[model samples]
Target: MGSRVMPQGAQDISDPFIERHLVIDTSKVNRNAERGGFTNREQNGVTDQVSSPRRSEIVNRSLSAVKSFGNDDIDLEGGDVEKDRDKTIRGSRIVKVRNQAVLSGLAYCISSCSMILINKFVLSSYNFNAGISLMLYQNLVSVIIVSILSLSGVISTEPLTWRLIRVWLPVNFIFVGMLITSMFSLKYINVAMVTVLKNVTNVITALGEMYLFKKHHENRVWAALFLMIVSAISGGITDLSFHAVGYSWQIINCFLTASYSLTLRRVMDTAKQVTKSGNLNEFSMVLLNNTLSLPLGVLLIFVFNEVDYLSTTPLLRMPMFWLVITASGFLGLAISFTSMWFLHETGATTYSLVGSLNKIPLSVAGILLFNVPTSLQNFASILFGLLAGVFFAKAKMREKSQS
Candidate 1:
């Protein structure tokens, strides 16, 4: 056959193109090479060789899975990133709350301890020994201060009414008794022993909680109470200058302290219900308690013959005496305010436990201030008591977390 050459090449039969012949190029070229040497199942212009429905579906599924796997990687990484961000925000909030609580607790502990130490000074160092009179003045300070604050709108308080007063009057009685007995004990007991004996109050409170609130105690709580009792007995035995009367006063103080706590919890609710201002906060309770205690304290003052002492006392003539006394009053009110703030920010268990923790430093400070005689044995007992307090706090925290 005669044929003309193409522009760039001579015609070959194996070529897919032969321009002069104008042949149709309907053939697959380098089929295996195009598929990277893989099998060409759709050969010979037919795709039925591997066209079983199940096989086709399997291949489609594999391709789809590969495509989706990449998308899933992206989605998973994004989701984890978002989750981590949310966790970071939550962690920050938790840390902030914890810091606030710790700071409040610190304020409460320092203020409370200072009030006690100053009170011990007023009673023991100053030879006041007039528990009722001291309480009366402190309560008067509280009333005056709280009134000023409430009127000035610095702190909101419910208005005092006869109903609310009646509801809180009983708890106020316990509060007064607690204060009086505490002063009596402080007059005779060293600060270290005072703190050791106060562990008994925790026992009484735990029992009261179980009975009043129908709460159950774990074995850990019982063990802590046992340690507290042992600490008290050991402290008493080692106390070189122990006074039976002082110990008796402290024992009474424990009962009244526990009673005041349990009763106050109930009374706070009852008083809140009768409040006219629809706001029965800690300030209102402080006002009601101290304002109502004034009359009772006055009566006790006369009964205890402090009226005669004040009339004859040269301390009344001393400006320093009045200044210290007034300072004690301020600290007392500070105790009340910080105590409420701590309890508001944290829980009751935390408030009570931190209170126990506070007594440790107070005991040391008191011993140093008064030069109260303390042997190593007595110090050991005091340390024992402090350790018990720490364990009790931890147990309480665990219980709270579980609940």
Candidate 2:
């Protein structure tokens, strides 16, 4: 057939008759090319060979069409896409949790250091009883400030109810115990020694959890607990001196701290039920606890006959006193939040280990800042105690893994 040409704009060249004829003509040409200089028998022998390339060319053209439309690309099924998204989300969550844990640890350390500095500086310039009074003043001021902030919407407001008050009452009592004992320890002991001894709380808490709450722990936890006890005792014996008042207060501080942690955990677990509220924010708890302490502290000041010191000395008027009190209060709050957050993020054992590491820097800072004299024996004791804490913590983690 001669080349068939379409008229100008002839219905956009839609012609099945022309297409059929063109295909027939192309087939004839391919047959002629295959039989070039070959007899019929030879052409028959090469028929399969000639058909193979033609089939391949058709396949290639089809593939090219698919490529042009991007249809040949692999299409991930719905399930596969969802699984990939889930994996990404899980990874992000894990990273976020770990970051929170680290931030909490650092905050606790910084707060601890700040509190130590402020307390030491204040005590060096004032009487013990007077310093206690100043602490009370600081709490009072904090409560007032926090209350104002809450009302102004800078801080969140917590619902106050009888049930909430009942639950918070005991916690505040424990808080008071911790504060008074810790402050008393500062009077006779260096900040470094006090911090080392503070590790004893971990041991005490473990026992309290086991005995009181019936919380089962792994063998490693017990081992860690044992190490902590031994370390604390050894550290104490090595660092022992005739500072009876300070030593006694530190022992009380340890007990109080342990009590605080145990009680706080219980309170946190049952806060919603006990308060008849959905959940209580930690800031609200802080506010309530500190507010309750104000009256108790005032009453204690009178009982201890420290009201005279407050009246005679212009401690409140001194900028140094205000500075120390403000700094210490903020540090106290920071430490409180960080420690709680760490416990929540990494569990008790890891939190305790991090706390143990904190003692070294605190001890060094104490000696340097307060001129705390230490014998070689005392230094050795501290080192041993720290090592024991590490071993115990590791053992506890191992036990947890096994269980």
Each candidate's lDDT (Cα)? Answer: 0.68, 0.59
Tell me, what's the RMSD of every candidate? 29.7, 25.9
lDDT of 1 by residue, 314-354 (tens): 87799998888788777767765565456556655555555
Task: Evaluate model 1: give its TM-score.
Answer: 0.73
Which one is best on TM-score? 1
Task: Please report the candidate that would top lDDT against the real structure.
Answer: 1
Which portions of model 2 miss their true places by more than 4 Å? 1-105, 125-128, 152-157, 216-219, 264-271, 274-276, 336-351, 399-403
Across 191-284, the per-residue lDDT of candidate 2 in tens digits comes to 6566556657667766787899997777666665576566667767777443778878878877776676666666755556765457555456
In model 1, the clashing pairs are none
TM-score of each: 0.73, 0.68
Local error of candidate 2 at residue 122 (angstroms): 1.8
- lDDT for model 1, please: 0.68
